[model samples]
Target: MSNRAPLSNKEIKTRFEAALMGNYGLPAVPIASGSGVRVTDADGNVYLDMIGGIAVSTVGHGHPRYVEAIADQAAALAHTSNLYLHRGEVELAEKLLELVEARGKVFLCNSGTEANEAAVKLVLKAGKPYGRTKIVATENSFHGRSLGALAITGKAAIREPFAPFGVEAEFVPYGDARALAAAVDASTAAVFLEPTQGESGVHPATTDYLKAARRITSENGAALVLDEIQSGFGRTGAWFAHHAAAITPDVVTLAKGLAGGVPIGATIGVGKWGDVFGPGDHGSTFGGNPIACAAALAVIGVVEDEGLFENVLALGERLEANLADHPAVTEVRGKALWRGIGLAGADSAAVCDALAARGVLANPVRPDTIRIAPPLTITAEDVDLFCDILKDVLSTAPEGPNHE
Candidate 1:
């Protein structure tokens, strides 16, 4: 390593702002190093990581086993495109199918958006024979920013500027079976819904709503697509949040936590829907790269061997229980490790900043909602510390929104 002083946090942010696009604006902190469930900033201050790279760091930062897998795979083989067959890519696909407890075909990509884009193709093909082209999504639901996925994404603000989305879609109110049943019909190619709305404050769908969607899609010759990109890979104390719904979906999208911070996405098509795509339908040059597949395999192995799913359940319960009595908290949304806090009257931005000042990292997902999706490998001490710091921040949380 070079024996030179590192850049300060402010300097790093300045360079990033100057060089990078303004899409994300300025970062809150410049993280230098991380391990397990903690990260140290460029300023040498350490923090308990509750955001977990927006739920992407599943096995936590710098996990020895995960590191070894990626290193070993890279040393042996890394990129092979889709032309040549590789062990990791094939194995990862099988593992994903097994995790979903379904017999299917897998399409690998590099992010949640890509996976959703593949899903759009899968549903389109499935419905093409019936002369269907429209997809059904829900209000306040976020699919991705890609043209195809954005069409199914129900957020009007983001979809407005990018008008004329690739695929046409119908938007229904989330958790409303009547609206969903009414919106979906023979002309509908597929019904896409999140098991739990992640970007929209971590809202979960009701049992009846999901059941209705399954029934409606089945009857209408439309595929039921579950967007589990945020809720899959044990984030919600289950292999996939839809598993708890006791219903099998025709298509499912996965990413975010799949490779534990390594970019990887998957679209799993169950039964007949798996055979939708023939050659030349779609392709990704770097999709299912050996290194990413190896990392995903390592993550699944670690989650199973260490029982991270159960840990998530326990940790989630503890968090919800601990924060329930806080004066500033009104309600907690989501399940397992994927949680969102609804502030009583305090502003979420202030609470997030306050928590950051107190050595904990979280995301203010909405004006009144704070999101927490820590590494599943966090220890009891980590949870306790986060709870204590969160409570303290809430006690002194700013009253109103002050983005300035």
Candidate 2:
């Protein structure tokens, strides 16, 4: 481990501000230790973690099983590179493919961006010789910040700066089958979409729209790529949100919760598209490291053994029902534990701040939309506590500028 002395929150913040580039805009609270759904700040003030590290800590913080898995893997063998095959990597790949019924194979990486980047390259390579170059993506959809993923991402503000690296892609309104059908043609290489748009305020794609994408992509000989980076691994109560839509994407991008906070990403291709990439086409040095794969296997095991999906379904219903009656809340959208609450006149960021102050951690996707996606392993008491705190915050919050 890297040697460094622990400092107070203020000291840490000061050092971070001085050294790091200003991009994330500085975090308000500096957290120290965390367990389950609770995290303690430098001052020892505990807050219920509703965001789950932006939906990455699927099994909650410091899960014993995950910890043990990592410890065991470290003791046995940490890494052997991609040159020699490792059992943990093969097991993880098999498990993921079995879960999704993906026909081809799995390519592991480090983050959501890398997974999407790999998918983009694979689609481009496969669609070539057929003259399929244009990629169709939905408006408000976020792939990643990398050049390839950013090129296909929908947000014009995020994409405009990197226009030089932009690919031949078209944008269409999300959840609109007609628009997607119109956008995709024979020349389109792939149609990429998030199962549930997490960064764009937890907007879920309609089942009809997903079905339409599959149909259109198939007809046009374009690969259908579903980005489940934020909604996979029981975050949506189902194994994947696309399962609810009753459609199978040609390629699926996964990350965030796959390894229960461990940095890991996977791109699973289905059918003949899996063979698009030859052995020498793509590779990663630390992609399928044993430690990460071990962590993922443990996460998967715990999710299955603990029946966390059922918990997600039950608690999600309660959360949605409790928030729906709030006068300040305009809409609650999403399935299972992944939900977004739209406030009527309150600023979403202000509401999140208030929740944080009241010992509950939540985040705002926009001025009007606040997303609630706690860990799937969160208890009934946790949901009830969050609801109570939210109710109190909503009751006392002052009306702000209604930007939405």
Candidate 3:
């Protein structure tokens, strides 16, 4: 019951350890401030932020435009609840629709989990009188960890704990069009796939696989839902990674970089499915608040106005090209800033730790795979610096047990 404020990193860590749950282990660094693509720890150590808060900060930290927009929105009005219409929400939805360029309507929420949940509800509602309840998702896919999303997520370790939810889902091997086709049936309500599997080591879906899913889902009367929570909003150089496959999904779930760093999620349904939810079907109290919508509008404007997509494309190419020839890097995968570097015989965790110790930050999505999802605005110099640091870290990283 101490009301005392923490004065140092050590004090803050101590307070967190005592008061917070240990689900995320412990934060490696106590960050005090961040700007552009860099963050400084309370201990005065600065590090290049390659993770971008796990691909959430698309426009990068403390962008002046984003700051101004949030400030202006807060000054004018913050929350009016979803019962009332707000101009910022309408503007953001319109901008998102223009970017996707498919016929659709958006349902806003608070996070990736909520977005997927909203999508699941919509699909179930639309397919209802049909008695379709099954969903088809791919193996190694990582949807958010909510009950409904967890059931659809392919990872058994996360789904097994909540068996009583009674949500039936089938998982097929990723990148296998035949397997995906075989899994969907007449009773399937939806087929969920990530354009690029983020938490499962950045595995991009093949064009054939995506097209096959689109075809099979349509044939089976199932909605094709693409979870672009991690790969959307210029993370993959394109507004949506599925654009590369040249197939439009029935539903698209988005979050992550939508509002730069602000927490927001959107479940957009294309064509007829967009109107599945009526006035009382689904809603969130803080979903389309003026502040978050304003933030998203600002983020979208900056991405387009500043041409961050081209930057992502150029930097992503350089990143992959530089690492492609590295002896330690087995394979470099992904398009744009969302990249996965597969290590040959080395442990990715050790390399990530080594990189962190050398004033750089990267993450190991799996034991053998490290994901590098820097901001869309990351510069060529930043990519070069990251490559140099990674090369040095790989050269000196100790051979040890691998833990993801």
Compare candidates 1 and 3 on TM-score and give the better one. Answer: 1
Candidate 1 lDDT, tens digit per residue, 280-328? 9989998999999999999999999998888889988888888877877
| Candidate that would win on lDDT | 1
What are the runs in model 3 whose C-alpha is more than 4 Å off? 1-6, 401-404
Q: In candidate 3, where is summed lDDT lowest over 10 consecutive residues?
A: 395-404
Q: What's the residue-level lDDT of 109 in candidate 1?
A: 91
Relative to the true structure, candidate 2 reaches a TM of 0.97
Instruction: For residues 1-404, write the lDDT of model 3, one tens digit per residue.
Output: 55765367787788789999998877877888899999988778899999999999899899999999999999999999977888888888887888888978999999999999999899999887898888888888888888989889888888787775668889999889888888888889999999899999898988888888888998989999999999999998889999988998999999999998889999999999899999899999999889999999989999989999898898888888888778878788888899888887678887888888899988988888889888788889989999999988888767645433
Q: lDDT (0-100) at residue 374 of candidate 2? A: 80
What is the Cα root-mean-square deviation between model 2 and the actual structure? 1.4
- lDDT at residue 148 of model 3 (Cα atoms): 88
RMSD per candidate (Å) reads: 1.9, 1.4, 2.4
Give candidate 1's error at residue 43 in angstroms. Answer: 1.3
